[model samples]
Structures are given as C-alpha cells and as structure tokens.
Target: MAERVNRLNDLTPREWIRFQKSWFIHNPPPREPGVLVHPGKFPEGLAREFIEFFTKRGQSVLDPMAGTGSALVAAVRSGRQALGIELNPDFARLAEQRVQAERLALGDQAPQARVHVADARQLDQLELPPVDYCLTSPPYWDMLRQPGFETQRQRREDGLPTTYSDDPRDLANIADYARFLDELVAIYVKLHACLRPGAYLTVVVKNVKKGKRMYPLAWDLGRRLGETYLLKDERLWLQDNVRLAPYGMFNAWVSNTHHHYCLNFRRE
Candidate 1:
C-alpha cells in the first residue's frame, strides 16, 4: 500500500474528526491534586487505529510503557490480545484494574488483555509473548513539570504533572539531551527483542520545548530505532480542538496548532 503523506493543517475535516474521536483532548477528569509528571493519558480511539492498522483479530499487541491502559483498552476494543508492562507500581495497578473494569463493562465484547508492573529498560526479565504489534508513547522528559511562574499560576488545584515517570533511572530523568536520546533509544532496542519478526512497531512521540531548548525526541527515535527496524513512515496526529497559540508572532515564534508524529517502523 502507498504510504499516506500528512502535514500539519492538511488533514481533511473527516480525518480531523476521526482523530478527535480516537483520542480525547489533553483535558482529563479530576484527580488527586499532586504533580503528575506523566498524568496525560492517550485516548482509546487513536490506540484502536494503530492496533487495527497493524494487527488482525486475536493478534497479540504489547505496550512497554502502558500508562493507564489506554493502548490495552483500545486493543481489546479491536478484538486483539493485549499485554503491557509499566514501571510505576501505582500506575501498573491502575492499568490492571482499568483493563479488568473495561472487560467487565464490555462483557463478551472484550478481547484478552493483561498488564504487568515491569520496567521498559528490563523487558528481558518479563515473560511476554511474541508481540505482533508494539504500540506506545514514552515520556517526553520533564516537560510535564510546571513551566514558568505564569504557567504555574494558571495551573488548577488538581492537574497533571509536568513529568510522568517518577523513576530516577527513567530516561526522562536524564538532563542531558544526548544522553536522554541514547537511553530512550536503548529502551526501544530492548523492545525490538520482544517483537516478532516482520511485525510493526509504532511509537507516538513528539519533540519537546523546555527552557528554550528543543529536544528532537521523535526524530531521534526514528533515527536510532531505524538502525534495527526499517523506518517505514509517519502519520501526524493533528488536533484542531486545541487552544490557539498566542505567541506565533509575538515575543516567541511558536506554532501550536496541535500535532504529534506517529513514527512507524518494521522489524526486518
């Protein structure tokens, strides 16, 4: 099949609505008021799209950083077997509970889904099946932390944290951009072992702006993982529902009309 060429602000109205339905906007329901570094969870609609695009019914899908079970729930909804590993014990338990609750709510409609509390850096210890498709979004450093005094002041009493991974050893914890890229790429290399031959791996990531520095996370991931897997293509997740940017031409030349890159790779 010919790859789809997507650019920011080029999606059709139908495509835009499909993106909205597949994933919820960044706004989430209320939670305990604490700094949630990685509190932002993915919507099931987008997850289902990746799951359906890469796997068949009853195929196994794995998520190494299964935050809150978004990908797992989506896989189940698509009638695919799902497995996940999370480092945080709290998040892992939450993911497990959410998967079970989803199954109960879905009744016979749900596929087999399971989640384990494990670190992405040490997938070798975890006994996971050969995954047909591995789809996930890793932490985007500490960008989740409150940015400036003005932004912090605007934050609500109960809001998501600036960084999700509390692990001191997490790749997001590394301050050096190069080191962060190396370690993050290493995690994906480890994941390469868990994928079946000729299977697909889609990573949902984006470059991050922190302290006036740009960390090209998505680009680096594509470059590094491309060494092990074929750099297939990318699809942009454009969001038209986001608040308009105020600094496009003022003090800062920021363009924030909503978009994320879905880098696709295939294990050779």
Candidate 2:
C-alpha cells in the first residue's frame, strides 16, 4: 500500500491536530521601539504559527495591508518567501529595513521577504509571484477616528501615529461604513488572480464599536469575500494580558473585548 501524503502543510499529525482547536490564547511580547511608530501591528509570533500551518517551507506568502512587515518577517523566519504591500511609505520603509535585518541575521540561506510601497488595490499590476498563502488584517472601519480617541491618546502623546495615515486612500480613513466594507472586499477579490488554487488566506480582524453602534467588520468580510474565495472556519485569538477598561461604566453594558477573529479562507 502507498503511504498517505499531506498536501496542505508539512506539519506532523500531532502539531496539525493541535491547531485544529478553534480558540487559542496568544499573548505576544512587547514590540520593539522602532516598529512602535505604527499604531497597530499583529505580532510576528502569531503570524508565524498561521504561516507555518497553511504553507510548506519555501512557499510564498502575501500581506496586503502589511503593517511594519509582521507577516513578512514571520514568513522569512518560517523559511518561506514573503511579499508585503504597504500603502504608507514610512511604514513600508521600516518594513523593508526589518526584513533586511531579519535576512542578514538568518544568513544567505534564509528565504527573502520584500516590501512594496504601493496601494494593495493595484497588487495585480505589481506582477508578484504566485502566493501559496496570505496573512493580513484590515482596519476596523475608521474606528481610530471614532468617538473614543482615548484608545490612541497615549500613542498621540508619545509622538507616534494616531491612525494608519492621513492619506485619503487609506481604508482606515474612509468615513462611510458601507463604502469601507466594499473597498475592503474589493482588495481580496482582486487578490484571487494572484493566488494559486487551494491557497489559504487568513484575515485577522475584529468587530468595531462606534458609540453604541456595532460594526461587524469580521462577519462582513467573511460574507463578502466568500463570493471570491471559499469561506472556511475561523479561530478566536484571545488576549488575556491587557488591562481591562471600563467601556460603559455604570450607564450601559459593555465588556472589554479582548478577542479577535482569525477568519480563514481558501482560494478554490
């Protein structure tokens, strides 16, 4: 009899089964001072686990909204090629520098990671290599500019970026909620051409709260992008380390939301 082949990833049965759990608590370490300029960034540690699970070594990974190259660095560290598209020039430059530093530390045999300073909507024109996986996250529909500027007050005082950018092209700057959802979905729809068949894309996001209104950003992305890619299961990424805030105090019911939706999809 022939032996079974694992077509998806190079993980062992034990490791694969472990990842099958729907929820995980991953509290990442503090960020380096250089990358702190960007207001939001998913940890490289979190990105690596997903990248390793979805792809084999040497396969290529793409991060459309690559903030400071977290996903790119993770890809390189996991022995895979990395491609990042960052709209902000300052963040893009920093991402490239981080990637280069990672490569130098890993030596010549390490996989290469590249950061392109351009709008992700035009990724098709970039002529990037076929990607085996994508790991990214979108802004929570201009929540940075919402009523609670308090979330960003510290970053502002420290002279860091309060939001993604002042560029009107940035999705985080789009004021209308419906338009924001459409624009976000459009980027993924265009991404279908660049992916190989059976490629997996993981979007790390959360719902947004504007005063009393709730914007289901994660659910909206899953539903809209389902038209372009196969909608797969999602994992809950729970963070337990952050200090809880009194969102509603005594007036209303509001819990300190500490979980993000790691929505998974496949390009079939």
TM-score of 2: 0.97
Backbone-clash count (model 2): 0
**What's the lDDT for candidate 2?**
0.91
Clashing pairs in 1: 22-45, 22-46, 36-161, 37-163, 37-164, 38-163, 38-164, 144-162, 145-162
Model 1, 125-179: lDDT tens per residue?
A: 8877888999999877655553542333344444634455568876666777787
- Residue pairs in candidate 2 whose N, alpha carbon or C atoms collide under 3 angstroms: none
Taken over the whole model, the C-alpha lDDT of each candidate is 0.74, 0.91
Give the C-alpha miss distance for residue 210 in model 2, angstroms. Answer: 0.3
- Model 1 scores worst on lDDT over the 10 consecutive residues at 28-37
